[model samples]
Target: MPTTSPFALLLDVDGPIASPVTRDVAPEIIGLLLDLAVSGIPVVFNTGRSDDFIKQQVMAPMIAAGMPSTLKIHAICEKGATWFTFDSTGAGEVQVDHDLAVPGHYSDEIRELVASSFASHMFFDETKRAMVSVEQNIDADNTEYRRVQADFDAAALEAMIRLGLGVERLEVSLPDANSGIEYRVDPTIISTDIESVALGKDLGARRALNLLSADGIVPGAWFTVGDSRTDYAMADWLAAHGHEVSHVDVRPGDGIPAGKPYPVLTAGDLGLGDEVIHDHAGLAFLRHWRAQLDPGMVINSTELSEASV
Candidate 1:
C-alpha cells in the first residue's frame, strides 16, 4: 500500500472540478482524482450541490475511473448541511444536519416570494436538503437576468429579516475588470441559496476536518479550490487556524486578497486561465498536486512555487 500524504485537497464540485457551463466533469479530471486518491491523498468534495448530484456527477464517474476500494472519499454537501463518505463500491448513505435547514416557515415564505415574483426567471430546487435555493438561468451580459436576480436577493433578505434570523443581508460582489477599485454587486447569478447563517464553506471545512479526524487522520497541510467568491471563506477559515492554505480561485477577480491568512492564486496564474473555461484549470491543479506526491513525476511548468504547501 502506498503511504498517504499529510495533505488533503478540499474541492468545490462546481467550477473547479466540474464545468460551470456544462455542469459535467471531464474524464481526465475524474481519472486524475482517482489516481490521486490511490496515491494516498485524501480528496474531499465540498459544495452547494446535493447528495444526489454528488452521486451522479462525482462519485459515479470516479467509480467508473477505477477508484480503489481502499480509497475513502469524503464530501460536505449543500454548503455545510450534509456530510457523507463513499468507498469504491457505490454512493454512501448521506447524513444530513437538519439543524442547519432554514426554518420551515421561512422557507415557505421564500418559496412563495420566488413563485410570485421571479417564477419566469428562476425555479426552486427541491433537491436541496437544508436550504432553500432558487436558480436563475444566468447570462452574464443579460441585463434582465441581473435585474431579476437583484430583486430576488433583496426580497430574500427581507424575508430572512422578518423571520428574525438576526442575520444581515449578504451580497456577493466582484471587482470590476476595468476599474479594480470598484466592486460590483454580483449575486450568485446561477443560484441564490438561503440557509441558516451558521452554515457556510468555512463551517463545511471544519466539518470535513472533524469527520476525517474521527477516522484518526489529521491533515498536515490543506488546499482549497473553488470558482466562486464565497469559496474563499473555507481557505480563510483554515488559514485562520494557523494551517498552511493554498487557495485556487478558478474564476478570479473576486475581490479577495492573496497571502497573509493564506496564499490565493488564480487559474490564469496557474497556466490554465481562460475567460470562460474551467476544466483545464482543474486538470492543471490536480496534476500539479499529483506531481508533488510522486517524485518521479515531472511537471513541465507551473507557477505554484510561491503557494503555501
Candidate 2:
C-alpha cells in the first residue's frame, strides 16, 4: 500500500458502480466519483460495457451532477478492446485498441444464427463495437437462465467455429453463491460476451494505467473494485507489475481466493457485512471510500478497523 491514500481508482462499472439487474447508477455514487476526480484522484472505469452504455449510463449522469466541462475522465470499455476519455462536454469517441475485435463477417454470421435459432433466449447488443454479446432475459415464471445460456453458448461457439473465428471459453462465477446459483460463462446471468480471447480486464487495467502514466499522472497506489471473479484480472495484472494495488470484491460471498495468486478482501471485510450484497453493497463500498478520503478525516492504521465491520 502507498504511504498515503491511493491517488487513483480503477473501478468496474456493473455490479460495483451500477446495478447489474436494473442497470442503474445511484446519484450519490456519481457525485462522489466526480468529487474524487476534482480532488485530483483519477478514476478509470474499466469494464466490459460498450461505449454507448458508458455514455448513457455513466457520462450522462455525471454531466447532470455538475461535472465541469473542462474535467476529463478516463475509461476502458469493451473490457480491453476500447479506450476513451470523456470531458465535461460528454463521452468522447472510443478508440478500438486491439486487433482482436470479432470480424464483421463473423459477427454477422453469429448474429444471424442467434437471431434465427435462439431469439427468445437471447438478444444481441447492437452497440457493441469490438465484440458481440447476447443478453438473457430471465422470466419470473422460469428463472433458470443458465440452461438457456448453455444452449446459446453452444450455438454461438458453433457459429464461431464455422466462421474460423478463433475462440476460447470464459468462465464467470456467480456474484453470490448462497443464492444457490452455480458459476457459468455469464457472471451476471444477464449477458454473455463473445469476444477475442486476447481481450480481458487485465489488459484494460494495463492500458488505462499506461495511458494515465503518459499524462504524467501516475498514482502512488492503485485500488480496483468489482463484483465478479473476472474483475480480479485487473488486480492480478497490477500486482504482477510490482505496483501496490488492492482488490475489493464487492460481492458478498463469491468465495474468491484471498491472497497470493489473487489478493482480495470481500465487501464484508470493508464493513459492508455478509448480508449486504449486490448494488446496494457496491454503493456502500463507494460511500466508504468517499468518507475515507475526506480531508477532515484522520484515522490511524490500527484504528482503521471501522472501515471493515
Candidate 3:
C-alpha cells in the first residue's frame, strides 16, 4: 500500500483519459491504466458519457491492450442511468434505468432539433440510452461552437417547456445544482447534456462505490479525477459515506472550488503550468499514483510528458 491503507481510483473519462481534441484514448494511458489494475488498484470509470461511447473509446482499447478477466472494472455511464462491467471478455450486459430517460418523443424532438438547426456545430448522440446529448462536432471550431452553444441550450429549454417537461438548466460555470429535479440542461465544453434529475455524478459515485463494495473491493482511500466542477460530487459522495477521499481537478483553470470537506488537488500543484491542463494533467497524476504504488519506480517523466502532448 502507498499509505496506511490501499487506495482505489474513481475516474471521469473525457478530459482525463481521452484527448478532448481527438476524442480518443492514447496508448500510454491504456498501458498505465492496466498497470494500476494489475497492481491491485480498483479502478472505476464514472462519467456522463454513454455506455456505447465508453465501450468503443475506452473499453475496447483496454481489452485489446490486454485487460485481464480477473480484473473487474465498472463503468457508470450516462451519469447514473446506465452501467455495465467489463474485463478481458469485453463489456458485460448493460443495465439501464429506462424510467429515468427523458420521453422518447422529447429525445426525438431534440434529435430533429439538432439536425435541422445545429448540424454544423453539433450532432445528436445516437448511443445515449437515457440522457439526450448533443456534442460539438470534432471538426467545428471551438470558438464558434462555444458561441452557438448557448443558443442551442436556450432552444432546448424552450423545447422542454413546449413538451411540458419540468426543467432546469445547469452550467459547469455554476457549481451547485439540484440533481433531483425532473429534468435539466447541462452544458459542458464540448457538449450539452439533458438528463433526469436522478442522474448525476453523485449518483454515479454511489453506484460505483456500492458495486465495488459488493465485490469486497472497498479501499480506505479513493482518488476521484475529473476536469469539471460536477466531478466533485464523486469525492463528496465518498466522504459522506465515511470514506477518505480526495479529488484531483485536471483542469483547474476554471478555479478550484471552495470549502470542500476533503482536499482538492490540481495538476498545477505539481508545477505543470496552466498550458498543461486536461489530459496532460491527468497523465501526470496517473504517473504519480503508479510511482506511489511501486515506490521509486522510475517513469521517464520527460518522455511521458512529450508523448502525452
Put down candidate 2 lDDT per residue, 59-147, tens digits, no spaces: 99998899987678988998888988998787667798658677787678767877887677667789988888877653421256667
- Residue 113 of model 1 has an lDDT of 84
User: What TM-score quantifies how close candidate 1 is to the native fold?
Assistant: 0.83
Residue-by-residue lDDT tens digits, candidate 3, 1-309: 122228888899999888888889888788889999888888899999999989899889999998887877899999889999998988899999999998999999999999999999999999999999999999999889999999999898888777666788864222223332478899999999999878889999899878887776768799999999989999999899899999999888788889999999986666556677777888888887888888678666565466446
TM-score, model 2 to reference:
0.84
C-alpha displacement of 145 in model 1, angstroms?
2.8
Sort order, lDDT high to low:
3, 1, 2
Best by TM-score: 3
- Backbone clashes in model 3: 0
Give the better candidate number (1 or 2) by TM-score.
2
Query: Which structure is stronger by lDDT: 1 or 3?
Result: 3
Cα lDDT for residue 97, model 2? 62
TM-score of 3: 0.93
lDDT of the candidates, in the order given = 0.74, 0.73, 0.86
Residue 179 in model 3: shift from native, Å?
16
